[model samples]
Target: MSDGIDDAKRALRAELRERRQLLSDQARTTAEEGVHRQLDALLARTDVRSISCFLSTPTEPGTRSFVNAAIERGIRVLLPVTRIDGLLDWTVATPDGDVTDGLFGLPEPVGELLGPIAVNDVDLLVIPAAAVDHRGMRLGWGRGYFDKTLGSMERCPPVYAVIYDSELIDEVPRDVHDQPVSGVVTPTQTIVLSPQRH
Candidate 1:
């Protein structure tokens, strides 16, 4: 039933995408502000000096605001730059850092290109997700970038997936290659999940 699972994931992702796109500007702004506050609080509770975060797309849960805030707070925030080889290169986020469209049209921060291994040194990893299950399985946007990164890390730190509050559901379609997150940061709350990773 792998095909069944894949089909379900695709269908769910499409619906989630449409739902996010339909959000009003005001509603989106409020959600973004909530996300920023939650992320700030997560940092306050942890010793996350260096972090790896994604530059959010328009319809995604806004991490750009949190990235900027982290920079202002003097926390080292690394943003992912997509690589054609299915690995990720990273760059340090700067105040007002310019971003350009990279592979898959994802907005990647423009700065000194650090290699894929750079993420290994981070205290925490804040990644993008379409949705995360209560058990912490992350349904990404049809890309295995984060899964590959997480699976390869030697001493992986706490990895958190950022999603909207409504996206936290009881269950999501999962596959053998799927990776489970340590927690999820939503617009409303930061829910720590327990799932043993392979």
Candidate 2:
């Protein structure tokens, strides 16, 4: 049974990877615009003091607009920095500043590592996922980065996994280490789930 489940997950991941790669430039732009609009709405509803988000990559759903908007709102913006111990550390970033490339070529803020902030200090956490289920289970890029990071947090923040609308699924294969999200923000809508169930 386990083997069959693993096989199914592998196949699904491959198919989704292909689809992500085939996204046309125009489609990518439209998706990004939609994400920005949703994020704007979220920001307006919440009195977020600080946010932790990622820098965008071509294949990954981008968060540049969200980060910029946070900066413009005078909200403290934090980005993840890869530690030598293979852990993700949070650091503050400016609107127009340089960032350094880290694991998997992900860009991170170029500044003093504020180290791990109190998870409660982060009002919102923008998570990156390849796909997410209606139950809020996230299928990451299989790096286990976010899983490990969240596990280490003293008090986990409200996590919002960002994805394209089409990437939302009814269910997903999950392991013991997989952490569920509090909500999911898609290009089309925001689906809130019960708190994280590890």
Candidate 3:
């Protein structure tokens, strides 16, 4: 069963990755703007004071604007620093801050490492995903970094996955360790799953 799930996930990831790569530059920009708008509205509606979010890579739905805007609003932002042991460390993100090369070509903050459990301090958590299902299951990049982090948390805040609208599906293949998120933030809407079935 695990093998079947893994194969299915790989197939879905390839399909989504291809679709993302094929997006036209103008379309990608428009989609990114929509994402920013939705997230901005989310900020307005909630009293969340702190969040842990990812610094998006080029092919992913852009989070740079959202991260910057969050910082501008005086919201504390924590970015992940991938470690050698398949766990992640946390670091504060600043608008003018630069990132250093880290694992998997991720650009990590060049500040103090707040250890692995720093995520417990956030009011909310934002994560990156290749695809998400309607049930709020997120398909990550097969590294399991976020999965490990999510699984270890004793009491977690609302966790959201950032993805393009089309990436949300009816279902995604699941492994035993797969963690479901509380909500999803797409370019067009923010869907919070009720009766979260994690």
- Which candidate has the top score in lDDT? 1
Local error of candidate 3 at 31, Å? 2.0
- TM-scores for all candidates: the values are 0.97, 0.91, 0.95
Candidate lDDT (C-alpha), each: 0.91, 0.79, 0.87
Off by over 4 Å in 3: 195-198
Residues 47-136 of candidate 2: C-alpha lDDT, one tens digit per residue: 788888888777666678778887988988888887767678877878876877786677777887777653447888888888888888
Q: List clashing residue pairs in candidate 1.
A: none
lDDT of 3 at 119: 90
- Residue-wise lDDT of candidate 1 within 17-93, one digit each (tens)? 99999998988888889999999999999967999999988888888888988999999999999888999999999
Candidate 1 Cα misplacement greater than 4 A, ranges: none
Off by over 4 Å in 2: 1-7, 118-120
Error of 2 at 98 (Å): 1.2
TM-score of candidate 3 on Cα atoms, chains taken together: 0.95
User: What digit string (tens of lDDT, one per residue) describes model 3 on residues 4-53?
Assistant: 89899999999999999999888778777888887788778778899898
Candidate 1 TM-score, true structure as reference: 0.97
| Candidate ranking (lDDT, best to worst) | 1, 3, 2
Q: Which ten residues in a row have the lowest lDDT in candidate 1?
A: 189-198
